[model samples]
Target: MKLEPVIGLEIHVQLKTKSKMFCGCSNRGEFEAPNATICPVCTGQPGVLPVINKEAIKMGVLASLALNCKINEHSKFDRKHYFYPDLPKGYQISQFDLPVGEKGFLEIDVPTKEGIRTARVGITRLHMEEDAAKNTHSDDKTATLVDYNRGGTPLAEIVSEPDIKSPQEAKIFLQELRKIMRYLGVSDADMEKGQLRCDANISMREYVEGAAPDENWAIQLNPKTEIKNINSFRAVERALEYEIARQTKHWEETGSPNTVQATRGWDDTKGVTTEQRTKEGSSDYRYFPEPDLPPMELVEIRDKQKEMLPELPRARKYRFMDQYGFSMADAEILTDDPYKAEYTERALSELVSWLLSLPEIEGTETEIWDNYGEKMAKLYSGWFINKLGGIMAQNAIDIRILKITPENFAEFITLVYENKISGPNALKLLELMIGAGGDPSQLLDEHDLGAMKEDKDEMDKIIEKVINEHQVAVSDYKAGKQTAIMFLIGQVMKESKGKANPETAKEMLIEKLEK
Candidate 1:
């Protein structure tokens, strides 16, 4: 019997504010020692009250608007009770029912066993919270320690509906969500640096053979289990796959009973999930409204944050096409990566429109063949997306480190248009000149690879000589042998030591022989 999986996600993103939620200490970057980014309030010292950071709210609200969430005009925080080594105050300050935003949805593409599918994941709540400290436990005197530097750091906890049926859906949702966050300046969402954390609960059930729960087709669900401590997208997908298989087997053997609702940690190397402990409910925390901080009224700030919302990817893609006349494929590639988009815009916007207008009016026989115009713009929007931009993003660096200056790349394209070089030769030169100073003239001279095909005067002499020497070729051409002229062009190029431009030589050869 086939089973169905119900999946929901809880994502915690540390906001990219300059300071802690309730203190003036910086929240980003590494600390020199344990508790380096701590203040009296962050360290949970007595007689200290929390001072809310205004910048954190700006980021959260901007992110909410980007996700299409309705911002809560009046929002307050509550205490979540927990006793752990990480919680120095014995509770975490979080928003319980009244969150900063609600009812947001992000659409994601998922690959199912059948085919690709798109799922709209609903955001139940996006609330503000203070982060807990890091804890390392060990048996030996050599190791285990706790770092409180991250404590009291502002974070946004986004809860999503159980609409994601598979791990592929979850992965794509997280990707799109991170893209939104980056565009909004909300958070870095860097998984490797632990700025973004994700947890998910999933359960599988069979299609209910009879009338179901609430008249909906209730797929009979098996005991659901959640895998915790998912730090990477690959891990999320692998752990969910492992959990689905393991849960299915356990149900078939044990007659399908509800496994205890406990949090489990995934062993990535072993590829198995082990039981950690029972999950806690909100009631278990014994929440109460935070008394020190007043409820925030966002009437004044709402409109401002609305203006700060970044254009979403799909919308930006259309704009790229409509405004720049870029192809859909090129626009999608460039806009998906933020740095590339910025680079393209910066390069294109700086150019004068008068320079661009020359490309069409100037005939191909004139300076239009020089690629003096449109070369830089084409590189910015079209070729740079996949070729240059992708390589930089993969290395986790900015566009500045991409080696070649924009001026040099423009020169290379110009050379290609001037028919000074062929496409293959241009690419070969680019590989050599990318990192260092790549002046087209210097490189062409050093490599002796420039197109000599356009020397019509010299190629004409060779073309005439070839026609005279090859009576068979001329006879063949007279007999309508098109291949005979091509043979003569090749002979001229070889005799000129490849300095004769092949294109010009071909035209001259065709003119003489065909005549």
Candidate 2:
């Protein structure tokens, strides 16, 4: 019998707040020495009261809004009773019934055999809680140590419904969620640094055999095995994929009746999951509302957080397509990050200003900009997203800290547009500008990087010489081989030491070769 896989995810994102959730300790514990950033409240010292961090709450609410969740007006923390070496309090302060947000949905695009398909995943809830401390195991297998520095860090635990149908979908869901968090400045969501964590619940059910023709069919689900400690997106997808195949094989071998629901941990290096222990139900936690903190009233800050929310990736994507006429792929790349998108827009605005100030103008500024804007936007998008993006990735550069100002970038694009520099030379100039700050024009002059022989008279001489030397290509062109003209243009550019403008060279080559 064929079976279908069911999967859901619980994601914990550490908020990028200044302090911990319930204590004054620094939340920036990723780089801190083990246990150095902890305080009495975080370490669970008796008689020390835990105070909630307001910034954490604000970030949680912002994340909820970004996820399209409904904000709960009154939400409070509960004590989750558990025993672990890392939990100094013997329990975690978390939300049980009334979480910060609920009843939300996230849409993801997945690739299939046919094409790209859009699916909506239901978000069950988004709750706030404190993170557990870090546990480290010595390589010698002699000791296990606990570091409380990560404890009390604020986390927004987002639970998604079992709507993801495949491992690919699960990966996309996490990627989109991470992108949203990064856009909101809520969290870095870097899995490598342990800022983002995920637990996946996966199960398989036999495809239903018979149902009424018009009735919606529902299959009975098998007991789910929850996989834990999946750090990265690739791990999440790989673990789930492995679990699905393993569970399916188990069902085939022993039947579903003998399969037991359990908790498992991914051995990333081993490429398999190992059983951790039996899965615990809600009652095992014995959750109780914390009497120390009162129910939070979020009405006052809800509107303020909404006002602070910037245009998210999805919305900005459509706007980029509508306003700039960018393709979906191009828009997606340009708007992947908030800062990159902002930089693109800023440079585009500066570019339009430069275009409007040009000497030739037969119409209103709006009309003029409209006529040339799409072409210019395409040019800017290509250079920024492809050329500059590659350079940044190669050099481990962050746009936020990059030396090239958007204004300078706009000037660089203007140079390319005006043919003051060839494409090859423009790339070289961009590299120099990124390494050291200077006016693009001044750099062009200082480095002698201007286009070579743009004057038709000089270009004609170069093209004539190329045509004379490349007799076979000239004969091919005269014999109606249109593509042969490119060969002549290549020779002209090579002779000019790559300073020759390609478009001008091509035109000159055509003029001389046709004759």
Candidate 3:
């Protein structure tokens, strides 16, 4: 029997707010000493009342808008009963049926051998909730420790429908979702820091070959295994892949597709999932409206948040491609970080202005862009993404802390575009500008790194000297060895200390050698 994996994800995003969801405790508990940020309300002391954090609600609404979720005009918090060492109150305050948002979807682009395939994963609901405290177990398994400081931290639980088809789709969905959250300025959504976490529910459904699951009436839903403790996006993909294989093997061995629903923990080290416990149903939680907090009227808040929504990642990516003539790959990278995207746009604008001011170029703004947009855009992306990005990575520098301003970056790119400096000299000038924060032109002059191509007479003399010194290479070129000219050009650049443009030297060397 042919089988397919049905997958859904429940993502919990910790909102970047100043205080806990139901109290005034500092929300920066992840950085503080354990239990330092806890207070009576968040720690669930008896006789203490809980006050909702308005800022957290605003952020939740903003995120929902970004996700294209329809906001619920009215919503309420419920007490989710559970017993755990990390739960100080013996219950969690979360949304039940009436969540903050619902019926949204996230679009992801999956690359295949054929081309880019776009998939829209449906979002079931996004609810407001409080986070559980951190649990630490001893190495010997003798004792456990709890840190209540993280308790009551504001969280947005985004539940997705079983729309994900494969493990790669799941990973891409999560990545796109994280980018949206970051673009909204609501949260960093850093998986390593525990701000954004995912629990995936996956099951295998038997299907006929070449038949759609929806069209096949014989297809039945198998019990799903909810995989938890997924720390990273890669782990989510790997864990789902492992589970699909394990379940497929079980079906073949037992000759039965029916299995008990369970919750499992992903062991990243062993690359397998271990059964944690049987999965609990909603009824098991005994969810009831919270008595301490009143129901919320979110219509006003939703309207206000809608007005505050910024351009999302997907929209910005498309805009970058359409406006700047950037390739899809380049646009994705440029728009992945909001700060980097802004920097790229500003630098491109400066480049356009500088190009228009050039004496040799004469055209309307649109005409000029239509003529040179793609070429200039490609040049800028190569330097920004490959060259400059590599340098920043080598120095362990974040784009936010980059010392090179967009204007200066544009000027440097202009120098390269106009062939004012050779490639090697351009690289050296860029490094200097990055280190000392000087103008590209000034750095070029100070370091004597200007391209030697502008001085035609001086370049001719250098080419003559290189031809005389490399008699063997000159003979090879004269004897129809086409690649020997490259060696002569290398000597010219070396003799000129990398100031000579290779293209100019190649032309001069070929002319001199042919003569």
lDDT of each: 0.74, 0.87, 0.90
Candidate 2 residue 196 Cα shift, in angstroms, is 1.1
Cα-based lDDT at residue 59, candidate 3: 89
Of the candidates numbered 1 and 2, which has the greater lDDT value?
A: 2
Candidate 1 C-alpha lDDT tens digits along 204-308? 776455655344334444445778988899999889998888777876888674556768898888988999988776688999999989999876777998876
Cα lDDT tens digits, model 2, 126-174, are: 9999999989999998999998889999999999988888898999999
Candidate 1 wrongly placed segments (more than 4 Å): 29-31, 111-117, 138-143, 208-223, 257-259, 321-332, 347-356, 359-382, 389-397, 403-420, 423-425, 428-450, 456-515
Candidate numbers, best lDDT first, in rank order: 3, 2, 1
The total number of steric clashes, by the backbone 3 Å criterion, in model 2 comes to 0
lDDT of 1: 0.74
Q: Which stretches of candidate 2 lie over 4 Å from their true place?
A: 112-116, 208-220, 359-370, 464-490, 507-515
* TM-score for each of the candidates: 0.78, 0.91, 0.95
* C-alpha positional error of residue 422 in candidate 3 after TM-score superposition, expressed in Å: 1.2
Separate clash counts for every candidate: 6, 0, 0
- Stretches of candidate 3 exceeding 4 Å from the true structure: 212-219, 464-488, 510-515
- Tens digit of lDDT per residue, candidate 3, span 143-232? 999999889999999999888989999999999999999899889999999999999999887777777645753466678899999999
